[model samples]
Target: MDRLLSIEPLSAAAFAPFGEVIAAGAALQRFAINGGTTERLHALARARADDGDVVISLALAQARQFPFEISMLERHPKGSQAFIPLDQRPYIIVVASAPTHQPHAFLATQGEGINFRAGTWHHPLIALQDSSQFLIVDRDGPGNNCDEIALQPSWWLTGIDAG
Candidate 1:
């Protein structure tokens, strides 16, 4: 048997229990940069990589076939992971609260990204529409940073509206 989930729109408040949504126009400190050429949203969230170095990298996530199904989830015990889309394409964001590990699904809208809090249980990078690229900020050092668990009965997410 498979557990089905309807993905909701990703929001900072809704996703607060698991992580922070990295999108513009949220309630955050803002300031002009480079003499007003660019605006900056400051101090969005704490991106920590304790005992490890913060490394910047890019990842190419391929789109999964329709009828998206999730059977497993992973977490980083040592650091927080941030994914910012390079092409402004929507993607699937699956996370679970601690203790119960109840799964929740969200679809990122255009020009949005997310930062998974350390130890946050989440599905791997899932890009929709087409293969997408993301700038990844994560930990890189000695430590068991990853833990994977098989979701009981699995989950199928559909009709994920991106808003």
Candidate 2:
């Protein structure tokens, strides 16, 4: 039988199982800096890779229409991955619990992003409506950290920003 998952609004507690909800105004140690010109939030979350070195890069992801069909889930054993949107557009996050393959989904809000835990199972970035740019933070070096599983019947994001 085929599985269809309803998309859910991204939240800290709900998403804590797989990763974190990266929201700026959501209680992450804010402090005034540089004569109050900047507010610095401390230690939002930790990003890890097996190699212990992280690199910042930009990825341009094309838009995928609604009721997105999920074909596969991939994971990085070496380190964690974080996606920060530069276009301030909404996006989809599909993840599943490791070993058991219990799936979870999320929709990123404005000024919000996510950091996938190292070795966490997740789908690649899904942009909604239009093409989007993201700040990608993940492990870099020589290592077979990436792992993937292609779904048999495949799952789908049935609902848009619902549930």
Candidate 3:
């Protein structure tokens, strides 16, 4: 049987347990640089790796259908993964804490991104637009950093329209 999971708006406070919310605004630290030609948001989220060198890559993600079934979740044991949207479209982020693994979904709006802490369980990218692109930052080279676990009672993610 499939259970329903509601998607909430992504926020720094709400997602703090699983990871850091990457966004720039008055709420975060900001400074002017390049002789006042640029404004910088400092340390939005730090990329972490236990062994391998941190690398940045591009991901072309296909749009996910609504009422999506989350059958399994994956985690990187040795590194943290971050996804920043390049297409300026909204997307969904599904995560769960250790032990209980009760899933929680978040809707990431335009210009917002997320960094999943190492060992945090998360579903793959769920892009809302067709042929969405993302800037992915994570570890490269090394020892089996990824792990996946199947959920016994799968979750049906809903509430994309509200997002």
Candidate 4:
């Protein structure tokens, strides 16, 4: 039998164990720049590259239907990966920790982004909208940075209505 995963609202405190939550709020450090026109949320999350230089890329992810079956998880052993939604649409994030590797799901609403810490296992992008665009920041160098593992008797991620 497949395990059922509960989806929870994404928050800084809840996600602190896996990685940093990228979002702008009153609690974050803020300042005005560009002649006081742009309010910058400084250093919300920092990217880590253990071997190579960090690079930015764009990804167009297809929408995933729910009760999504999570069969595998991947991690960057040498760097951290960050995803920023370009279309401001809601999406799903699934992560697991080391050893036990129990999966946790989070619903990322609009204006919220995330940066996975190095070696954090995570499922690929699960977009709720068709043809969603995302700006990705990660390492671009050599040495097979990605490590993936297949989950036995995969988990069924349900309880979210992607409407």
**Best TM-score among the predictions, by candidate number:** 4
Q: What are the Cα lDDT values of the candidates?
A: 0.84, 0.82, 0.87, 0.88
* Most accurate candidate by lDDT: 4
Pairs with backbone N, CA or C atoms under 3 Å apart (clashes), candidate 3: none
Task: Name the candidate, 2 or 3, with the larger lDDT value.
Answer: 3
| Per-prediction tally of clashes | 0, 5, 0, 0
RMSD values for the candidates in order, in angstroms, are: 1.9, 2.2, 1.7, 1.4
Candidate 1 on 1-163: residue-level lDDT in tens?
Answer: 8678877888888989887878885548999999899988987767899998999999988777767878889999999999999999899888987524568888887768889999999999888856689999899999699999887677888765333
**TM-score, model 2 to reference:** 0.91
- Per-residue accuracy of model 4 over 113-163 as CA lDDT, tens digit each: 899999999999999888889999999898999998888879888767766
TM-score of each: 0.92, 0.91, 0.94, 0.94
Report how far off residue 68 is in candidate 2 (Å). Answer: 1.9
Ranking of candidates on TM-score, top first: 4, 3, 1, 2
Alpha-carbon deviation at 154 in model 1, angstroms: 0.6
lDDT of 3 by residue, 1-163 (tens): 8689887889999999988988874147788999999988898998999988999999998888877899999999899999999867889999999525679999998769999999999998889887888999999877999999888888898657623
* Model 2 lDDT per residue over 1-163, tens place: 6788877878888889887767775557889999999988766668887756799999888878766788888999899999989888888898988635657878887868899999889999888856689998999988688899888778877657421
The TM-score measured for candidate 1 stands at: 0.92
lDDT of predicted model 2: 0.82
For candidate 3, what's the RMSD? 1.7
Ten residues in a row with the worst lDDT in model 3? Answer: 21-30
